[model samples]
Target: MSDGGDEGDDAESDDASAGTTHALRPLRTDLAPVVEAVEATGADAFVAVGDRFDDDLRYLTRFSGPDRPYALVVVPDGASGDDRENGADVGRAVCCAPALFDEQARREFVAGARARGDGEDDDPGDGEDPGDETNAHDGVAREVRTENVGDHAGERAAAAVAELVDGSDTDHTLLVPSSVPHDAAVYLERAGNELSSTDAVTAARARKTDAELDRLRRAQRATAAGMARAETVLADGEAGEDEAGRPVLRWEGAPLTTERLRREVNAALAARGVRDAGNTVIGAGPSAADLHYVGDEPVRPGETVLLDISPRGPDGYYGDMTRTFVVDGDGGWERRAYVAVESARETALAEVEPGVPAKTVHGEAAAELAAYGFDPNAGEGETGFTHGTGHGVGVSLHESPSLTGAGELRPGHVVTVEPGVYGPDVGGVRLEDLVVVTDDGYEILAEYPFGIVPEKRG
Candidate 1:
């Protein structure tokens, strides 16, 4: 939906990470345009009468309270809590706080919220302690009127929205987002069939806020340490079994293994209050060649390994990065390919800027790859490097404002710049980093040393 085109790559993602946001954190400046756009779209006071599990939910309403796994409403303040069966802007958002997203599942959820003895006394600030894990001055968790309210996610949400819509005395329209699951849509319809779909929510998340960027940067810096630690594990020597007989990676026998290293990185990030969900991208030999490969095969001497580490930043901000290294020593065509990737990567980076289109950057990288001895476009039995130059990185590993194929670059965007040369014959070599786009230029979020000189191949 953004002006950016698809890069010749496949980096699909879903909003699965559980994130927490702090209050008094500058309200997202980007969200304003979206709310304005929503109002302009002829919708009455905008109703994100759906679930809260994706980036849009986090971006629009700051609904990062304890995980409820259900549907919600992004109703703006000054809205009424009454129903608008005919659709009204009563200036309040009514939400059913269910735990699931099924249709029949959510109706019961709304019934539960209505059945509560303190139903009239509900408030978002009940048990929430924003100072705990949230960063906002007006914490979303602290604003909870219904925590763990029901079993059906979207149904509960629709019931709450329907009630608000009916109660409101002003004529208003209800809006839903494309991110809402179809099942949830059915639930909203069942409630009264009054839900309308729109792209406002996702469009708002496409661009990020300053406070979000700050947290993303910090999370990325922590990821750098994790990446360095993974490389450091390989830097020690061949990965083998330890005295305990576990297949551990030994950095001078201090104790290292794919699993152990994974725990270490998570431990490192957790110490900084950043919880993680996935394993570090430490793949060895052929496995490393595959993008996003998460296996943990031990690294043997004289083999190339890829280390792509993406860790969560404070709240829900995510940091993504990639670096390739050889175990024992560097040699053969591997080193040459790494140099090629680094060149292609920089070539792309050089073209990145506010006014410049994203296409130029990908084109430059592709051109550099073609100019190199490696084949940028190979087919069938013989192919080298088949992926995009980069993509957007934020709440999710891949978000918006991509850097692939062809697309216009915009300010306030954060994207990755990774280029690679992969093939069955030559394995793979790639380097990636997170960058923030400014009005004139961009800044790299993840910092690492490029072009490592191997003393010898193990």
Candidate 2:
């Protein structure tokens, strides 16, 4: 995860340089498609208002500010005849952010634009440097100007957004995402501008850029490390008898509970510079049947132990991977379930090429499970393939291009390919891998072993 090399003898130096290098190489986001989307909406501009939690806004501005409200307004290019004559095909953007986040916004937004030479010739017209707080550049094809507001930043930012729409002479409609804050939408409407909700941002975010892919790969590598740590612990665990005279997994003379295993996995993720994002699922035996279970239970030997880790990286990208392991198995239900799930995973992954309907992937996985004698249509509280094959992963752990949805797979689409089976009486078996749709096929982001037996790493 440390950019593909050993930290070397001077760990401190490596850490310091890592931050420096990361700042220098900002993630490149293309806004041209978003601009075209805005134009297609028949709206003058696209306005998104939310805090850092709003993945749509974060995707547009790449500014990871605090939980306070911020706004971004995007206007399509060639708004004027002169601009069209000059061949300006990319749209323009403005970030109405809180005054407190000026520096961070400049570093994340303006600096990236400057690095990409996207705003070299643009004049701020305020005598301040282009990188100044008043006007910053966007690395995308468009020119992004930053406007800092203070005191009641949410309303003030909404007003700034209104001004952006009002300033345009020929256009007045403001397109916003459905997730836009209610107050912001109301303010925009009261400002005499018609507001419409559009899925343009969500559609654009489904396909990632090269830089985004790099961040995803880094996060997944960290996730794989976390899985390795958990697997190693499982491999090192000794078989022992519990107080009830039942078999239990013990590590270092202590019972290895799901909570303790999760801690070990999380620690490994943190060491690799990623946070678990509260999605690290470690379940054993009957608990494994409860898909999203986050409980602490005994890890009995010869039972299924499902580990599903989805961690978020520093750049706000997520990595998701799941693997099931069984210790001292007697080749019974767990083994059969593992084989079926692995086969279903392969069937799902093979359908991950561009232009393929996302639902086809899920159908294939389901069919494979059914072929293995597991009911693909098992209802709630019943055992079999119980969930979708996978979902897209990015800024939000689950985003667009869902495998169970009607959307078609496209290149640059990063999605998980997880096929799982569950039964309360036996347990669960799941195999997952993060993959990105490629021009011809797909590429698995990380490679980890697949087996019922946990593998130990040095």
lDDT of each: 0.57, 0.76
Cα RMSD to the true fold for all candidates: 10.0, 5.4
Model 1 compared with the native: what TM-score?
0.72
lDDT string for model 1 (1-458, tens) is 12121121111111211143333233332233444554567554344433335666655544454255544454443333353233333233333444332332222222212212343334424443322312222211112235436446665565555454455333345577667667766665665555567776555565666767777776776666666555555565555766667654456655444566566567655655566658376665676666666656655555566767787766577888777877545468787787788888878888878878877777788789888787776553355667777888777787776666455777777888888877654467888887777777787764556644322211
As a TM-score, model 2 comes out at 0.87
Sliding window of 10 residues with minimal summed lDDT for model 2: 1-10
Candidate 2: C-alpha lDDT: 0.76
| Deviation in Å, model 1, residue 175 alpha carbon | 2.8
List model 2 lDDT by residue over 133-154, tens digit each: 2222331333333444543434
Find the candidate with the highest lDDT and give its number: 2
Residue 287 miss distance in model 1 (angstroms): 0.9
User: TM-scores for all candidates?
Assistant: 0.72, 0.87
